[model samples]
Target: MFESVMWLIVVAGGPLLLALLMAYVLMTRRHRGPAERMESDRATKRLYSQDER
Candidate 1:
């Protein structure tokens, strides 16, 4: 009985631990910032005309 319970725990915990590891990896991935902030990041929220050329 004890050995069976331990085997069950190992089987169940393996997938659970894998899921948590995957979740952690996905949540920590780098993401793009807000669109407005990215647009205004250069000079005072304005894109320079000369910089365009």
Candidate 2:
């Protein structure tokens, strides 16, 4: 019974942990300042432009 309960907790916690991590990432990303966002955008554009060569 103890092992079964542990297994169930682990199974339920996996998705909960993943969801928390994803939410944290999304919240941080959404709160970036304009300059920081612009820098990220510029970096992405630079990377893609280099890839086209």
* Tens-place lDDT digits, model 2, residues 1-53: 99999999899999999999999998888577999999999999999999999
lDDT: worst 10-residue window of model 2: 24-33
Q: Which residue runs does candidate 2 get wrong by more than 4 Å?
A: 30-53
Q: Write the per-residue lDDT of candidate 1 for residues 1-53, one digit (tens) a residue.
A: 99999999999999999999999999999876798666667555355666676
Provide the TM-score for each candidate, comma-separated. Answer: 0.53, 0.54
Residue pairs in clash, model 1: none
Report lDDT (CA) for all predictions. Answer: 0.83, 0.94
In terms of TM-score, how similar is model 2 to the real structure? 0.54
Top candidate (lDDT)? 2
Pairs with steric clashes in candidate 2: none
Candidate 1, which segments miss by more than 4 Å at Cα?
Answer: 32-53
lDDT of 1 at 18: 99
Model 2 residue 19 lDDT? 99
lDDT of 2 at 17: 96
